[model samples]
Target chain A: MNRTLALVLYGIGLALISHFAIVFAAPYLATDVVIARIDKVRALTPNELRVAPPTSPPRDLVPMGNADTITASSWLDLRQGPLLFEAPLPRRGEYWSVSIFAHDSDTDFIMSDRDVQAGEPARVLIYGPGQVPPIQSDAIIARVSTERAFLLVRAIMRDRNDNADVEALSAELRQATLRPAP
Target chain B: MGKVFRWVATTVVALALGAGSAAALINFGGAFDARIVNGAWETGRHTGSASADPYSRARGAIYGLWGLPPSEVVYYTALQDDTGQPLQRSCSYQVSGGALPARWWSVTLYRDYFLIENPARRYSWSSTTIDVAPAGNWRIDVNAAGEGDNALPMGERDGVFALSLRLYQPLPQVLDNRATIELPAIHRGACQGSSS
Candidate 1:
């Protein structure tokens, strides 16, 4: 091949690689920034749930977070082993949900209040890639692709003024626990 | 040695060009993406889902991390008004619509993806907080001065902004017919001279 043609081809190849690398790394970098910020404020630890008050204006912990919902989250590190995630459900006819997001920003699993009996607690066996499921449990089975994932719970506060009810509900959610699978 | 230097120079330039273009697209491209467009609002078909494309997933991380898929929630964003003008913080607008096809819904204004700071401490209005007409229609005023009962305060800042419509537990019809759903129309009202 001609010298000029070879150089052009090499440049094009490098450019394409650069472009795809940015596209692929964006999610992981974004997730890392988010987790770091959340940790800074909440001092988050693995498997320990922390509930946030309604998103205050001017600055919200998360972008586009609803001001009318009480939210709680727990950082999950499943590299060591499977985790048992338990969540408490609110009354029927209320809007509430628990979702798990993988490191790549995909929704690994999501369950709404309607999925379980009203006001019943939810249990799930969360395992990462190559991890084994627990021997026995009625909990829903969920698996994520990455060892680093997170669980988010959102419950509507119909009346932002009367937040006592929602506060209590979020407290109940905080009671939900995560621990190494037995 | 001369030929090696030329190759190195060309490769460096190519890498810079590629990285710069990628950054620009990720930052300036439509935040919610354009997989589906209904009127002026748009959404990503697989946002926050495993099936999402790379661009969609990247955009979701910046604009809506931890967002649910369309089955649980649908998010539509409008960066411009009905007239194709950018939504400015210096202007007043009227958002009018009837009942939406969802169990619950809300409209919130954001600047750079964060809720605009206002004295009312109110960043959004939802189905539960809005005053519905006897006919089930509702109108929210995006007032610059933060006036009116059903108003989203634009604060005193001056710049472009976005309006996000989130429908939680959207009805099956909405997911099936995303392109035909009737979203609220934003009509530009008045604007501060030379600022909008």
Candidate 2:
């Protein structure tokens, strides 16, 4: 083969290898930011929702957050065992959603207030890979593929005058608990 | 020895160029290309889904969005006015539209991916809160000075800003034919100083 042709092939081969490597690694690297934010909250209190301060400019941790609602987040480490998730049911006429994201940023599951059966507080059992949960009555069971995951909870805020109500909802969410299954 | 050195050098350069270019393309390319443009507003129909390509996934990661699938929520963003001019903080703009077909929706102002802080501590307006005209239309003023009722305070930041319109639980037709949806129009208004 000609020297130039050999060099071209070598370069192309290397480029292809690096391209795939980056694509596969990007999700892990991108997830690092979320992990760090979760760690910060976990440092304050483990296995509980840490409500972010109402939307303000220049907050480094949470990006693209909606100002129209109050947001709270929590990190779950399922290595120990299955964890019980519990939150207060939103008041009537209010919209709330709970979204769980896998380590790769995929939306594993989402449950809205509308999805909850009437008269049931938001409660679920999150199971990690290869873990089985004890039978529980009247609780949602979600099996997650990753050992680490995150949850984003949002509740509607009506207007500026509704700051107090929003704060109340935030406090209610912060009361949410994630504990090892019995 | 010389041939081995040449191969190693080429491999290093090629890997660097390849990874760097791929990252740039994922970050800077038209990653949000599943767009439906209605005047100045543009929304990606398939932004946060398993179907999204690697580039879109990378962009969503950078923005810290664990994007909901289009069936749950649709996000429309605009960085320009109806005239195709960039939205500047130095100038004011008006967003006017009627009700959207969704269970709920909101319009938010952001500068550089973060909420624009103001004295009122207000950064967005939702359907339930915004005042509607007798004819069922609504108007919102986007100004740096926070003037007028229903004003979205743009703050004093001197740079381009963006508007994100979020529709939660949109109707089936709106999601199926997002390209032809009638989103709010952003019209350029008075200016305090020269626009950048």
Candidate 3:
């Protein structure tokens, strides 16, 4: 090939490689800040829900978080075993939701208060790709594609003055357990 | 030696340009499947899901939409007015709509993905807090001076801003048929100047 053609081919090859590199690395780099924040909160215990410190104007690890609700999150390593996650159903006239995201940031599954039967707590059994629960019960079974994932919980508050109530709800959610399934 | 040096420089520049442009397009390009509503607002059809493309995933990460799915929460954003002009902070506008199908919803203002700092410290209004007219319609004023009971204070920032409307627990139809959803209308009002 001529000198100019060889140079053009070399540049095109480099551009393609760089584009793919960025595509593969984007999720990890973009989610690093949030992962770090979740790590700080989850350092005390693994697979346990960590209630983020309440901040005025709502300092969320995620951008554009809902100012109307208090959020709690947990990082799950399902390789250890299946995890049993549960949360109390919201009171009447209130709204709440539990969303599980894969390591790649895809939302694997979501459960809302409306999904739960009347007066029943929200419960789900999350397992890795190869693992299966011993028995199927009333709890929702969610199979994640990746061994590592994130669980974000949100509960609405009436207003800013309702921080006390939000705190109470957060405390209730802190009691949400992530334990090995029987 | 000169030939080797020139080839290295060309390769480096090409790689940098390619990677930077790819990342920028994924994060900023309006190429995803966003259904337009009311001639102003746009909502992503598959924001946080396995079906989302790489660009959508990158955009979702930048937007800090961690775990929630479209079924649980549908987000609608408007960076322009009904006339397709940029939403400037200096210009006042009115957002009016009827009750949405979601169990709860809110409209929030953000500047470059962060909440705008205002003296009132208010960032959003939910279904429970927003006032409704007798005819079941509601109106919110977007003003820098913080006018009206339902005013979303724009603060002193200039340039373009964004309005994000979150519909939590929307009805099945709203998710299945987003193009026909009855979203709020954004009508531009008076523009004082570029400063606000």
Candidate 4:
């Protein structure tokens, strides 16, 4: 091939490869930024829940957040071992959910208020990839492919003006914990 | 030696151009394409799932991380009003709707991907927060100052904004038929100045 034609073809091939590589890597890269930001801002150790304060100029890591909801987050480090997830549920009419995301931003599992019994708290056991759970346990068991995952707890408020209710709920969500599995 | 130097330069330029173009496309082209269009709102079927295509996953990570799968919560975002005009912070809009087919739902306004700051500190209205009018209808005012009984603040910033409608535990009808689902209609009202 001529010199100019050969260079053009080489450039085209290299460009296509570069484009695909970036696109494939973007999700993992973006998710890493979020996990790092939350860790830095919250100064949280793995499995410790911190209910994000609903202040103006919201301080949460992600955008398009629901300010009306009291959200608590924890970085689940399954490298240590399987962890037990526990949280209080809201009333029947109110809304609440626990969403677990993989390192690549995939929704590994989500257990909402509707899943649990009306008055019972959520009890879930999360293990890492290829890890096994107890053969007999009341807690809902799930497995994630990544060693590090994210757990989000959402508690929706019925009335925005209810300050006392908000604070009380925030306190309860802050009590949501993840401990080493028994 | 001259030919070798020219080849190296071409390779570097080609890689740079490719990477830069990819970044621009993902950043500029928002997450949802034409997959599921409910009026102005749009959503993808595999959003927040591992099965999502590379483009969808990349865009979702930047636009909305920690989003639940559609089986748990279907998220719909609107960048424009029903009239095809981009939603701007300078304009007031009336978001009117009736009961949605979901156990719980919320409509929130986000400017530049974050909740707009305002004195009221109000940013959204959900199924429980909104007061039902006669015939189960409700209306929310999305304005700059973020005032009113049902107000979704867009803050004082001058720029375009987007609305996120989240339906958690959607009814079978909504999940089975997303394209024809009835979501709130965003009707643009008065504009503050020359800004459209």
Candidate 5:
């Protein structure tokens, strides 16, 4: 065996170790970029969840009979909790919302306009894959009961500026007033 | 000579170990998505400590990292006008909020993405006007039609029950969309005892 050949092999090994160490230490040398990015940006909240459960829970429940004058009331109780209305909900302006009784609870949230399919049960999700974090009234619920259930609703008014007009319109809808037909 | 051989063996093992750990980190990190949408990344979080039901917390953490602007979703909840009036199922909902899109925007409804077939002709918005709102923030009504009303027919018995809100093309400062939006609380319906 040649002594020069052995020494040359040892030199090659030393170079490789140095290279590997540098590569391994690169991340630490680069001032924690990932950590800094995380620190600088704030985490966004799921607006849907926040809206469903406001800072304080509503502390009352009342029943409307077969013929309750919804228009006469200051505000109606909502049926079902936030879980019923799915996420990525539309802001309250001019769309219709449905209220349903949560299966085993007394709470309720307004249904989003997206889930109101005629002739089917509303069964929307609260959160799901590739979806925005807001909840809406369009979820298809499995069933609905009219026994003074909870109801929280938002509407998308065709006329944003006509607040008083829209409020009157909403009251009219709630009243369900109909004229006699010949 | 024996010591040298032992040292070489130990170095090889250590290298192998370090390589394995780095590989694991990359694999786990990839599971989370980070592509930008409408100039910002939209993601989720399930941090509601009330129910630690399975993937809720994990999903919540992922949402926190996405860094997208938040919009108001507070209006979607069910409750009376800051009172205890029981709302009903046979009603419609109107939604509106936030600024218009600069580079595309949309509003979608989901029971956690299990979308329902709305009675209305429209389902979501990526481009333009809905039921109608003068503000850049739009609104649409979700319910059955009637007089003096431009309503989209609703699911008969299956009318809307629960829902969520999503804002796309969100402005940068709407960071506290979650904390700031004025949402209603879920009030319990009258007890069966009261109804009976």
Candidate 6:
């Protein structure tokens, strides 16, 4: 009922709004940069797929994408597909390796994980050559001219460290491939 | 009278909200604290002797779950604690007990989640080439660009480095009991205001 009281109430409302505004607006105000997917998700190298080394590992490894990022077989080939890629599904406790490659100007950036979840059993992304440059050489991966894509592969609980099991990957449909544009 | 109630209610609500906000903003232990070092949140018992406010501990744990993968992992974001202490950055410290990973381990530093190209032309260190104390337990220094140049390196994060400890296929001895394995403090190098 008093003017003084009304003014105080108004001030409180203003303060609340100001605080909320700052908290929510920050993300929008800040520019969000995109991370590129550098390497193609391939099979495993023979060495990486091997289960027992002369030196056995002491414990089970939550295998990250050091090997499966590429195909172990030299003759294997993958191409850019529709925006989505269709890969093998992973069984329970299994996850696919995923990498986010971002190239800023000349610098090449890489983020890879063996655990890109294929839990849903279908559909993943394969950023095409335009999105990811092509493979120039062993050391350099170029942006393929064909449109790249993303795919979801079926992940299996099979032991990644066991090299013997990986041989099956080449034969079975368990592994998914991204193809170059038709 | 009606206006008075309205104002009183508004003031009470405002103060309450302010108090809540302050509590969230309040940070407990500085970066070196084990629980908070993983992130802004606190951590569970890591078999260490350190004091940290409970609130900070909980917050740091939540952050760790999100940023950290499963088990204990590290990152080097340039953020400060309540007392304005440098906690995490692209640079960090990692130590191991009893044969650090016979299968290749590295303390890799990254600017963001992605590794950065540095003038040092180096991205990480492994069991080999990495200089350590003869006892096997060792410590390495990390900083953003030049950290020791000033006051605890607590200012802007520009041109700074962030570090992460990566143990690739860690051997059993180090993995099973990493918490007990002592980690040396991340020191500021050759800076005027840093703790050296």
TM-score of each: 0.93, 0.88, 0.90, 0.91, 0.27, 0.35
User: What ordering of candidates by TM-score runs from best to worst?
Assistant: 1, 4, 3, 2, 6, 5
Per-residue C-alpha lDDT of model 6 across residues B51-107, encoded as one tens digit per residue: 323333333322221122213232223333323345454433322333544344445
- Residue A93 shift from truth in candidate 1, angstroms: 8.6
Per-residue lDDT over B1-196 for candidate 1, one digit per residue giving the tens place of the 0 to 100 score: 9998989999998899788877776665434544788887877788778777677777788778889999999999898888889888777899989999899998988877788887777788899888999999998899777787688887776666888998999998998788888899998888878644
Better of 2 and 4 by TM-score: 4
lDDT of each residue in A66-142, candidate 3, tens digit only: 66777677778888888888777756226777888777777787887778888677889988889966574888998
lDDT string for model 4 (A111-153, tens) is 8887999778899999899898888999999788899888888
Q: By DockQ, highest first, what's the ranking? A: 1, 4, 3, 2, 6, 5
After TM-score superposition, the amount by which residue A166's alpha carbon in candidate 6 deviates from its true location, in angstroms, is 22
DockQ of 1: 0.70
Stronger candidate by lDDT (3 vs 5): 3
Model 4: CA > 4 A from native: A2-6, A91-93, B24-34, B147-149, B193-196
Model 5, residue B93: C-alpha shift (Å)? 3.1
Query: Interface RMSD values for the candidates, listed in order?
Result: 1.7, 2.2, 2.0, 1.8, 19.2, 14.0
Chain A TM-score, each candidate: 0.90, 0.83, 0.85, 0.88, 0.24, 0.28
Error of 3 at A149 (Å): 1.2
The DockQ assigned to candidate 6 is 0.05
Displacement of residue B31 (Cα, Å) in model 2 is 7.0
- Report clash pairs, candidate 1: none
Q: What DockQ results do all the predictions give, each relative to the true complex?
A: 0.70, 0.56, 0.60, 0.68, 0.02, 0.05
lDDT of 2 by residue, B70-157 (tens): 7889888888998998888878888999989888999988887788777777788789888899999998899888787679988876
Candidate 2 backbone collisions, by pair: none
Model 5, position A73, has a per-residue lDDT of: 15
lDDT, candidate 3, B1-196, per-residue tens: 9889879988998899888878787766335454345478877667776676677667777775573667778888898888898888778989888899988889988776667777777777778888899999999998887788688888886755888998887888887767777788888898986442
Worst 10 residues of 4 chain B by lDDT: B26-35
- Two-chain complex of model 5, DockQ on C-alpha atoms against the true structure: 0.02
TM-score: model 4 vs. ground truth:
0.91
